[model samples]
Target: MTTNSTEKRAVRTSVLRASFLYADGATRLTDKYHTSPIKIAKSFPLKDQLAVIVMDASPGLLEGDCYELDWQAREFSHAYITNQSYMKVHPSSTSEEAMGSSISQTFRLGDNAIIEHMPEPVMLYKDAKLHSTTSVHLGPGSVWMQAEVICPGRTLRNEQFQYAELRSSLSVYYGDELIFAQRQRVVPGQHQLAAPGCWGEMTHMASFCLFTDQLTSSQIGLIKQLVDDLPATGDHQVVVGISETERYGLVAVAASTAAWPLQEAMRYLWNHARNIVLRKESVYFMYS
Candidate 1:
């Protein structure tokens, strides 16, 4: 089936804005707005925090599609945000139209606020190109944690690393000071992604970052031990490393042949960090 031109361009750009506030002794989704193809599926209350799932109505991101998401948490509020499914990037129609899709996300937190932003893995199709940027601003005593997984084009189809390009940039600011910044650009045809000091033999990669003043050296050690304890067999080999940031918090990177192992490692470290920062247990969500 062919897509109609009008329908394809109907929602070239979509926006989602959500705000959480601590009220009535619990965190609540006080305000929210969304455009077509992007909406909040639902929000669930877990312990002292609120969990919200963002869902995309369209099949996947198409060429020229752009998504903007903004989230805010009020003082003492704790929120967890996740996507319902993989962020699928479709192939460009032609080499000349390889700019492809983009996603921009911004997060702001008030004093003592906490946010756990964990989304599903990204699946890039052959010839697909995607650019994603994330900016976070934290207030005093606030914490922000994010986890991301990137999968080399559909591996079963033998299209691994066939994408035109993938660029991701992230910046975190504590007050007016930039605590962490990272920029990654990968062009499969131009870069030796599988060579030493690069991705090596790993087909998937995951990154986790926690920004907060509550980070401790002992906590980093425990996180490293957690990553080391993950089972690494021939079928599902994974290599993960953790390090402290320039100022506060820590960053962990993992490379694996499959996404599941990386995801598992991310979850383990996320739980540990949450406990250290918020003194809370892991909150599970049912992904569709």
Candidate 2:
């Protein structure tokens, strides 16, 4: 794997790679590799599946820092991957050139394999810049679910939308055919994100994507009902929309004035999708 940083100066570069395989009756961490600031914190068995957490030792991503992560789930294997804390992007100094920070992730799933990737929200500090990309490849009968939340900035400090720039891209391919692709760029100074066609009055946003062949019309209806039941009052208010992709998948997006509403909505949809596709119950994650 290669770092995606374009900085000319020396910076921290790290990589974490892991592979999960199924044998006998359970999925196991077959092979793993990692570098500084990012490593597999631990793994625990969840029935017949496995749950792994990746931790970043550093406080946050600094200017010119780059991280690469790759994971593969073998045929029939099931695994859930998550992060320990928020993906905090530190600000770049105005006195020097801003190389910013970047993170690249790749996931591959074999036939009938299942992977649930649920990372914490991303926090952008004032004047921070970040570039993130995720690529996924799915085999026949496989299922992949990913949820992401993005914060404008430190809202408590009245620094909302103060980031210099944020670029994010996601591409999902079923075998050799591309089924879904999304690209987003946010530069507060250049765009009116609060406009009607943009983010409007929302300050935080979240996205949940589920790719599976087991989705049925009944399941989709149930998911919609779950979203409709969310509170739309006071601090719990959230605007959510769910739609099916061109292929075998669905995407749900939510926006709110705060992060908690969006997180709650996404989690609800995530758990519902897991039950429909994997015939498994929700397993709550404990965050420190």
Candidate 3:
């Protein structure tokens, strides 16, 4: 609820809180509440499971806009959340008067529950400023999969890294112990994000985190090998790397100037990881 320059900028905030319950051998959307500019729709064929599509009623994020979201998956239930389209952060006003937008999402996964919080890439316009945070709290025997993608700007329009600032963080906790964490802050022209050791010449970067329990050393090696084998080819070059976290989790990073290649790489990783976790293939539909 706190914002900067409230007097000079018009604050547009939208909030959505929802919970999923398991009963009668199926999951139900037990609780749902949303404010302006944010809505949730369960339009998929899986009524027993919750597949929610987050709809943004507004044109896009504007200066001084803030979004707050909270989602919960009760014990033994499954939930999947996706967005309708790519998030667009438009340009702000003058440098002195420019305002930054923020988004915060919190997820609670109960024991034996599963939740997937995957959304489309965020496109930042020239001089756009944005900050986002995602917090996940997991119970014993629960699984939470999350990923994030950020693009510098529209490449076709020749607006690469013209944004003012971008800051984001993701934290996963299991019973008050932080199992995995990722953080990034980039201020174009001021930050050396394109250096040889950094993103280099890449314009888009993505990260994925998988939090589960008790993975053997061989499994972790297999996951890393899968990531290293993905081909970065054909007009959209991408480079990806994967490693095991200290807490029996997996972290994957991919970079590409084009969004599609990075997304493809993530999809491959997720499918392979799921096979390792569940011992079988599962359906995960991701589309633009």
RMSD of 1: 3.3
Better candidate by TM-score, 2 or 3: 2
TM-score, prediction 1: 0.93
For residue 194, what is the lDDT in candidate 2?
Answer: 84
Poorest stretch of ten by lDDT in candidate 3: 41-50
In model 1, the worst 10-residue window by lDDT is 2-11
Residues 78-156, candidate 3: write the lDDT tens digits: 8878899999998877466666898999999898788877788899999889999999898888878777778899989
TM-score of each model, in listed order = 0.93, 0.93, 0.92
User: Alpha-carbon error at 182 in model 3, in Å?
Assistant: 2.4
lDDT of 1 by residue, 1-288 (tens): 975544433338999999999988999999999998999998998777898999999988888889999999999999989989899999975545346899999999999899999999999999888999999999989989998899988888998999888999999999999988999999998999888988888889999999887777877677667766775556788888888888887888888998888887777778777876677877655232
- Compose the digit string of candidate 2's lDDT tens values, residues 1-288: 875454365667899999999999999999999999999999999766899999999988998889999999999999999999899999975534677899999999999999999999999999998999999999989999998989989888998999999999999999989999989888898899988889888899999999876678787777767777875557556888989888888888888888877777777778777887778887767232
lDDT of 3: 0.82
| Runs in model 2 lying further than 4 Å from the true structure | 1-7, 95-97, 231-234, 286-288
Q: Rank order by lDDT, top first?
A: 2, 1, 3
Candidate 2 weakest ten by summed lDDT: 3-12
Give the candidate number with the greatest lDDT: 2
Give the clashing pairs for model 1.
none
Prediction-by-prediction clash tally:
0, 0, 0
lDDT score of residue 90 within candidate 2: 95
